[model samples]
Target: MGHSNVSNFVLAVTVPLPSLLFYLSFVQKCDGDRWENEYWTWVCDWGRLHPLYLVNVLFFLNVDILFWVVGLVQQNVWLIDPYWTIIPVLIAHFYSAYPAAQYDLLRSRAALLLIWIWSARLTYNYFRRELWQWGKREDWRFTDIRRKDPRNWWWKSFFVCFVSQHTFLVGITLPFYSIFTNARPWNAWDGLAFLVCLSGITIAHVADTQLHSFVARNNILKDLGAPTEPLLNRGLWHYSRHPNYFGEQLFWWGLSLFSVNLGQSWAVVGTAINSACLAYTTVLVERKMVQEPSRADVYRQYQKSTSVLIPWFNRSTLVKSKTS
Candidate 1:
């Protein structure tokens, strides 16, 4: 751990072995601003969700606990440099530090920053919603977890919500974390890679914003007793059934690209892991919506009419209109 060039990738894989066992222990009742209370609230029963959701919740919980330790290490002892400096500095110093990668620091750093901004924005957006839910109740996602495993909520949550989410968060943030730990400067390739990362995040951001705005308007109409439908025929929604997830996926991939520019590491694995988690979310959405007969048909029709990832003007509709 002394040299910026070295890290225990093996430790990364093996350290969480006990977490894999995850025996559910004493869980506190929900109440207060303390960490355990928050965990309890997040882990409490929801009255819905499949067994797979419990697996995700457990994973999320376990990873979070690990991250808490990492966070503590970061605060007390200085192992890695702060991300803010690690990024631009490493890109600038790639040639002198890790020359094999060019130290193509500029392009790689750019990619890292792109992922940083986009991921942070999306995360904060959700954080804001969580705050808004304050004084109301915990997230429905947690409710689903708790409801599924009532007696084992204590130990189950210790593994699921506490450990798993933090774990994913660390994996997702590793590209930047590695840069911070390495402490080099930017290189020429870093700039190009950064630009590419920027482009993907920008595209994703616009698409997500458009889709969210559409949903907001639709919800308003529904409240007013006016007719409402999913906005699949227009805007970014015209392209993907899950535009936000698409953006989130791109954000992680952008970060992984930077890691590839750096050296041999598990950054690519991080991206793949993130994809698997999001895929789980996508499947849940599919299953839940399919439960409603009418909604399912509209969703199925939307699937047929839309492009999954690419956004277009739906020129086919335009061309048909002209011919008619």
Candidate 2:
């Protein structure tokens, strides 16, 4: 409690939750045409949609319960980060398995491939930080929130962190469901969606790589008894305070495009809400940067001079140009 050790837990806490969710949803139910089983008739009660909808809800609810229990017992609320990285893959693969009359398998394949690439990059980043190692802990953002209200942090973390993330996951994944069901042939719109998604993935990869390099260099400097530098302002960091976050938000919006082009216009609601959530996340992260003792002043300048999330023309450079 004196100093928050963010990364100090076993991989057991992180790995099993998603594996269990997958087992419950896909593996366990895969015994010989279970969807056609008669039990769903009673449970679904002749709803237009199948019982898998209910299963999906229960699956997430189970996930929440698991998170809350693990969070309370381990006293580590950071366990959910890995799940965040992989949930999209789970949702995409799950929905894509359901049959459609003229199912665009190619489109689903493209979406899944892009999502997997995104997932792989994020998961690698998480592991590279040694978060999967025992004693490795949660992100500082969650730790800071807990520190703010220690007495009530347990319940607050449950609702604010776990529940909020669950809601966002569900909302953001709606388009995947739409894409799976809509069997429209590949068109120019699909091509556009593919290009947008590819762009997002590439942007995020570059941003993450630049960030990792900066952090590693700083660590090396600190270890060698040299002066550590200020926050990163080069590469993608120069244009936006959170280029990775911007790329992530754009990626989801691009996925939403597939649904929209397929004529599921309502899917835009999910994309819009998800975008707002990412914006809120950016605000929270910036708030943390402004409050940190070491980072506050320098980060304040960065925040003032750079776009908060979007990558726009560098304001600092523009000002320097005008001044000269």
Candidate 3:
């Protein structure tokens, strides 16, 4: 292996070693009598059945349960938002480190590099939006839901915040599991997947940057006692009302292509579910937008001429035709 590949491999193997060792030690300490041996054997067998998934489940539960507890104590469920950008990168490395992992070296390296880039971009955007504040606030949707039922929010948030996100995070990352299991030589499909993944990352980065700038400028306008812009209709916003959402969906789908290349088509299930969720989220966001008195009418007009998710030609011409 080249120096770069060797370095990546070493990092991957070490990143998850502490957790793996702890788990093994616990298992060993528990093993003894017939019944205990049988239980441990069953657990080992389960791990053998799908080491990558089993490890991920353990990791997910550990991190998620902690997040759940912290959310309850802090009265804020925003912790997972930043981690959403992080978990996939960790999972990629975890998969790479698993003893049973068998992957084409180049393919694994490419996947890891792309995942790191994606994670960095998303993490940066998230922190920027938060103004580098940690746990300042939860998502608006979660806050709304909590306000609607403060009485039940405590228990409800367990399932709503942690459990649902567990499914989405693990499901959407199915491609990582698939990628690590296949040892097929890198080929044209790998190249195509790389391009798609890179394109998605680029699109998302640009759209998010544009949106961030708009928000920052609006804050300045508000501070100056000037009327803030009611809507962002420049850059990617001109092409699609939710270009960021589109870019996010594209990223997951592009990752799914890697699994498809390995004949693990089932991996697409996670990406599909994620897209469905994003579609629903888009609806809620637009509904919220239209509820704003200042922006309602203008946003409605913008919606008429702009695609909801995908980038496309402005439909202003069609709007004009209908009016005529």
Candidate 4:
């Protein structure tokens, strides 16, 4: 078969097969004790000790290996970008539907609703940014990396793209595991988490919308052979250089609160790691912005006046610094 056909076949089988098996073997049974075989029982026992192991295995097979092979075949390592908005919702539902899941119905339902909202917003933004084109372009960051080391990128991408995502994506969703495992009643903490998540979603939506409009206008300007704006400095961008990122961080941290409500504070580690990764990404993005001849000086000045990731009043531009 052709390379495209081969990759399609792999995607078709691997993506749903593990999830189907998991549902049939475990979720459908609804009782772990019913497995009579010693081997199945042993597997169940191990799964309980490492509650995330089964899901991790599913991700490894479905995403890590599947995407790596597809990337190699297609010569496009951007397969995971769109899926980033999707996988968390799947993970949340998986946990909620797990045979051993014992979460409070209200809390689980609310969490699921919030996740769906977040997913919808992000997925819409991604498609909007792509002008509704599917796989028309890869993210600039990945393109840059591939350009730097084209010879070894195929192998290196497995580690750089898939494996690193395995860490961040799985880690950030750890709270879902905690929430499903615990049967704690809905409380004030859950309310707080919901509000924070809603707020984050709103902020991210507004920031992304403004940025998208700005980019579209610039494209029009470019087409007309007119000078485009140097940078977006209005709305949320006026207060923070990356309000969308700030909003995303808030959403994850808010999700972590659900685990905290269940007294499993350790789940916050995932959100913390996600934040650290975002901070590093922010630095990279800012450096790239500064490299642009058209926008470097303007962006640098904006950086001096604006918060990096959080919304705050801009510093007074008139306040002269010692260096100045």
Judging by TM-score against the true structure, name the best candidate.
4
User: Mind giving the per-residue lDDT tens digits that candidate 2 earns over 57-147?
Assistant: 6545666777777788878876677778877787676666543213587888888888899899888878877634533677787888899
Residue pairs in steric clash, candidate 4? Answer: none
Task: Name the Cα RMSD for model 4.
Answer: 3.9
Write the number of the candidate with greater lDDT, choosing between 1 and 3.
Answer: 3
Position 233, candidate 3: lDDT:
88
Q: 222, model 3: CA deviation in Å? A: 0.5
Assess every candidate by TM-score: 0.59, 0.84, 0.86, 0.90
What is the Cα-based lDDT of residue 142 in candidate 1? Answer: 54
Identify the superior model by lDDT, candidate 1 or candidate 4: 4
Across 15-40, the per-residue lDDT of candidate 4 in tens digits comes to: 55666577557665446567767876
Full-model lDDT for every candidate: 0.51, 0.74, 0.82, 0.85
Model 1 residue 42 distance off true place after TM-score fit, in angstroms: 36
List the lowest-lDDT window of 10 residues for candidate 2: 1-10
**Per-model tally of clashing residue pairs:** 51, 10, 0, 0
Q: RMSD of candidate 1 to the true fold? A: 16.0
Model 4 stretches astray by more than 4 angstroms: 1-17, 30-32, 36-45, 317-324
User: What are the per-residue Cα lDDT tens digits for candidate 3 across 93-175?
Assistant: 76776655789999999999999999999989998998766665789999999999999999899888878888888888889
lDDT of 1 by residue, 1-324 (tens): 333213333434343454344322212232223435554445433201222244345444444454335434432111111221122222223222221222234544554456457646654554343332211233455567778977866556555544554456555655654453443566554555566566666666676567566677887998999987743456666666676667666656766665665673675775688688878877777777777775788777666666655555555576679999
